[model samples]
Target: MFLKGKTALVTGSTSGIGLAYAKALAAEGANIVINGFGDADDIEAERKALETLNGAKAIYSDADLTKPEKIEEMMKQAADEFGGVDILINNAGTQHVDPVEEFPVEKWDLIIALNLSAAFHTTRLAVPYMKEKGWGRIIATASAHSKAASPFKTAYVTAKHGIAGFTKTIALELAQHGITANAISPGYVWTPLVENQIPDTMKARNMSREDVIEKVLLEGQPTKEFVTPEQVAAIALFLCRDEAAQVTGANWSVDGGWTAE
Candidate 1:
């Protein structure tokens, strides 16, 4: 119960890595506010799953994080329900794939809004409450692309790089306020988004899934395996600990040595 009295807001938590983080925090006794843009029924189901976890109270706030106004409202809803946010996981994001020359302007804009600007919005809104309380943890789900890059994902790579810079600046500004801002960069995590991308990549290359995984995704990774959400969540939980007060403005990578080379 490291987070026994903390209230955590995990955006895009209805499924995937976000959901895993919510569960991990709940296991440590953090009250969870799950955020996602989805059907009400799906949201309710996710809320129920979180609630079923012992020592955790789960609530849902459906908001499209790409919109600033909606994100503000979601923060208010979380604060209202959970008292105040002690931990914020900025996990809501999307990716678009296209050659730079052919990339749609609208897609680029949407990627920035969701993956980068959403973090800015949430941090700005949550900072005041955190400052008032004298303690807070802000974790952004950046990507290995933040440091490296892959083809056909120009917008995602750009947004992730922006997030790294954003996290560092916020960490410096909020350090004196007992708030820590950091980013977790995961490589080849086997989430739904990644799974979807696998098929698309396969289609593009006219290769089998196995061939794509072995020749493409694992080509740069030393371990040649997907990093699990649990692994990433464990690091996230550690960053929220009182012991990690001095560990701000860092990008913790769970990349299976993808960036090591």
Candidate 2:
């Protein structure tokens, strides 16, 4: 058990990649703190599901990442339950797609708040505890868009790029304290947030779903497949292990060769 006796706080983990990460960590013997912004029913359901996995003590903290106060509160709750966070996965993010000329300011602001600024708030709160313990892992869920630009996603790209930069800088600053920060840049993972956009793109381009996947989404990928959430979670689980202690300030890509070209 690589993470035995450790505690991990994974944000936006009620479903999709975040949920997968929480489960992976728990399976490694880490007590899990799952955070999500959703109704009580759905949150509780995820909480129960995680608890049943290998006797892991899974708890839910419903915090709106857009709010700094709420982020602090969530950190406090996790610390109270698990003594301190050994791992912090900044995985909560929202996306918006629109042409630059017509993009809504509100949407841009919201994406930046949740994707980029929220990490800042959460990391700030988590670091002191980590420094005191002299050991921690901070993983930010960046995207391939962080390194490469795409059409109609200015705010999303900007936030992801900011995450990469933020993680790198913090990794340097926190190295002496036995804390490491890294970013995972995934290509295309089929999550509800992404699946919802498929129809919108199809309508806008007047193409079938197959056409969208073949000609637009997976067109540049050498593997011609969407990266799975479980695959990404596996990499995340590895990074949280003690053997990966020397690996910091890195932006790892699990993009199915999407960015290799």
Candidate 3:
């Protein structure tokens, strides 16, 4: 496998898109560090599964991404175990829906922390190791919201937009170092993150669950299909390949034409 012998660290990987990322990397034989919160037994099962997939090691880190100290500890653990993160996927995120003025102050802070700031913290800690090795891949899971706006998702949109910008800036800074940085902007992935947001959106827009899925969620995309986590993870794997070496600073849209409108 092209990624054999490399090490990858995927954040928010206990389930959903994050888990998909870890699995894709493991299939290519990359030692993996999966981070997030979930049931203890289920997580251990996935960790063991990853090792089986790669015939390499896989670790789980329950680092609270919002806390800088915990992030540092997680990075340290990766360094100690696998030298450092050769590929870093900052895919952890949360969402809340409400009018801008009526949005919860704490929710806004939490969304920003988990979605945007955590990526920043992880990138900073991982970059030095990448630079020293003269090779690295940094991919962030931005959203179609990063390019377009939807009602009642101010904080999520803002954080994703910030991720887009962050990817561009880092790409330039690391361009000469054989390290590529990019953002994968998917339209509406049918994950827990998106599924859980429907209720808040239903409440915000006074719509039923069916209406939220049909009119509110799928209305923007011509395809009218939810993007799969595997699809998004596939793009991330492509970014780690040598063929994608010149593909830095770009935001790839896997949104089924959601942004085409």
Q: Would you list the C-alpha lDDT of every candidate in the order shown?
A: 0.89, 0.89, 0.95
Error of 1 at 86 (Å): 1.0
- TM-score top scorer: 3
For each candidate, how many residue pairs have backbone atoms clashing (under 3 Å)? 0, 0, 0
**Alpha-carbon deviation at 256 in model 2, angstroms:** 0.8
Instruction: Give TM per candidate.
Output: 0.95, 0.96, 0.99
Q: Please tell me which predicted candidate would have the highest lDDT against the true structure.
A: 3
lDDT of 2 by residue, 194-235 (tens): 787777668657889989888878887789899999999998
Off by over 4 Å in 1: 38-42, 203-206
TM-score-better candidate, 2 vs 3: 3
> In model 2, what lDDT does residue 168 have?
96
lDDT of 2: 0.89
For candidate 3, what is the total of clashing residue pairs? Answer: 0
Q: Which residue pairs show backbone clashes in model 3?
A: none
